[model samples]
Target: MLDEVTFDIERGKIREFVLATHAGDTVHTSVEAARDAGFPDVPATATHVVVAGHYRDQRAFVAKLGLAYDRVVVGSVKWTYFRPLCAGDSVRGVRRVAADTRKRNLRFVTLETDYLDAAGDCAVRVREVLIERGAQ
Candidate 1:
């Protein structure tokens, strides 16, 4: 497992992320809508936004491991959300190397990341496979 990377869930960033992705969830952008939905604050962030950050953090770790980006492609991502992550929450992700296998001319690296909330509770788990072409 690699060191954890942390991020703050800012309301403005969440709103912008939803807008950029056209998530179509008003609760992600409007506090009023979230409150009307009975949330104490803005509801959980759009799932893709959280996953994107997790992917980015893992990519940085892969880079630090001296992996060349030009030969890498994302294979798959599976996400499990345990609970809602409201605005102002702090999220930290830790990456674990799940498996590495070579098939023909490609290498598949599978990784899992656990996203922890401010109270150190697991909020989400993401499993991703990255294919490295031309890997030995």
Candidate 2:
């Protein structure tokens, strides 16, 4: 056995994902998350669900990297809502590193993920932006 150990994560500094708009994914989940955070009246619809879940996912992603937050700015989410994610439904997504930019006071990492659904052979897409603060 080795007496010491070391690790590095610089190589995977960024990550992205794409998902599909699915049915059965009610907006309830998103509304609940928002309500739990002290906000109520969030539209509990499929469209809102994806947006809210996407944000939560983004935050989780940053937390996993042990990033410290001082300032964070999120870009708008552009997604197309479609059939619910249920039985016999199929979807596709693309996850990749988006952008890494820093201001004078802090460093920022922006990650974007897109999702599409199989509806009329047209895919609906959802783009999520996550900003990580103080990352150099």
Candidate 3:
């Protein structure tokens, strides 16, 4: 893994993210609604895991990877969920470079991050593709 960081999943954060993203799902904001939906508590939306970045210094990571910070852009993202991430969950995200290659005039870097729950089980896997422009 290239780096790792752990953070708590708070109810308020989940609610705010739900509202900000217009998820239109009460289960993401209301514990009671989530309970009714068979969840232990308000569950975070899939993309909410992106908040993990706030816990780390991404610029340092980019520098460590030798990637041009100004030229790097997110190309795509994929998420695989193994279990629901709830409001009180504390997850540790482990990041690694899955692939790196140059095609034509662009450099493509594939990064994979696995969010592991408190029990050490992977709750989600995020695959992100970053493209660096003018890297040829």
Candidate 4:
């Protein structure tokens, strides 16, 4: 696993992410609405971590794995949410290469990132599949 990355999920970022993603849920944008819905604060939208990921520069790790940006294509992304993520939560995530295989001219890589909440409980897990095409 690569070194852990930490991010504080803030309210403004959550609201921005919700607005940018066109998430029409009031709970994701307003703390009052979220609290009314039983959340401590504005709840992050699904996949909001993708925005938080910007704080961690994973490009170096990807380059270390020999993945050329031009050759890599994101195959799929899967997220398993174990608990609601709300604004003001500080999360830590560890990323590792879960699998790698080559078939014909295509190389498939599975990267997994597991995130933990401040209480050290699992919050979310993200699995991303990347396909790299060999030069003809």
Candidate 5:
């Protein structure tokens, strides 16, 4: 099964994230700076912001798949950026099960998340591997 969710990339949120992360990059925090840098608007948000959103969308699906919270651990995460996600862009995340494997008492599931921009163009792809311990 696949799970999907959409999120709006608001300017305020981007600025707040920039401040919280101490990014010190004006382009990410100010529209004027981004425009000066040749961007149409504020530059793309920090990668972690999109990553957090992706995980938020995936949490419920993981639980629905019968994976207990305590038993599960993150194995790895990889992100590939195709294009910048500017402020005011609406992005959608589509997550699907990629692989499932069992090794002894451990079970591993790989999830692929495709992030699409407002124009429906793929902007980023994330692959996350999760491990469930003591699971056959």
Candidate 6:
């Protein structure tokens, strides 16, 4: 039971931070290459590492709730890459419930977050999908 569900059935569901990038986050050499390739910035794809981390975080939360694929009540994710974050740039991370829904025979949830750089510029937007697996 996610905390946001309006239904009278579930318990409070909370989101655990999945990933964050900050100053000192190791940037692979490939990121530098992309910047040099005239993309005006490091290839955004490399940032998937952050997303993967968050996914792992989410998985842990699900497990703690005794939920498996067939027991998900809702799921959704949305990510926004705002700008390039160079190496040595401090970044902040935060995550919270964005929205929740039960429809079309399925439950849907969105996890929203943002990463900000030392300069106070948004570097990345994180959106995660949480889907409800039928009760296990």
CA RMSD, predictions in order: 2.8, 14.6, 1.1, 1.2, 2.5, 11.6
TM-score of 6: 0.52
**Can you write out model 5's per-residue Cα lDDT over 1-136, one digit (the tens) per residue?**
4688778777777777787788888898777889998888886554644544544745677687678778899999888888777877788888889998999888899988888887788888889899999844
Model 6, 1-136: lDDT tens digits are: 2222111100111011112333232222344554566543333333442533433465665664444755564344455677654433445565555666767655666776567666657677777777775553
Q: Which ten residues in a row have the lowest lDDT in candidate 6?
A: 5-14
- List the global CA lDDT of all models: 0.76, 0.40, 0.92, 0.87, 0.78, 0.47
Best by lDDT: 3
Q: Write model 3 residue lDDT over 28-112, tens digit each, in one string.
A: 9878899999999999998989998889999999888888999999999999999989988999999999999999888899999
TM-score of each prediction: 0.83, 0.38, 0.96, 0.94, 0.85, 0.52
Predict model 3's lDDT versus the native: 0.92
User: Model 4 segments beyond 4 Å from truth?
Assistant: none
In model 4, pairs of residues that clash are: none
Q: Rank the candidates by lDDT, best first.
A: 3, 4, 5, 1, 6, 2
Instruction: Show where candidate 1 strays beyond 4 Å.
Output: 48-60, 63-66
Q: Which candidate is the best by TM-score?
A: 3
Tens-place lDDT per residue, model 2, 98-127, is: 666657755555544444445434234455
Clashing pairs in 1: none
The whole-model C-alpha lDDT of candidate 4 against the native structure comes to 0.87
Candidate 6: segments with Cα more than 4 A from true spot: 1-46, 49-70, 73-78
Give the per-residue lDDT of model 1 (tens digit) for 69-125: 888989998888888777878788887888888899888888888888878889888
Models sorted by TM-score, best on top: 3, 4, 5, 1, 6, 2
- TM for candidate 5 is 0.85
Winner of 2 and 4 under TM-score: 4
Clashes of each: 0, 13, 0, 0, 0, 25
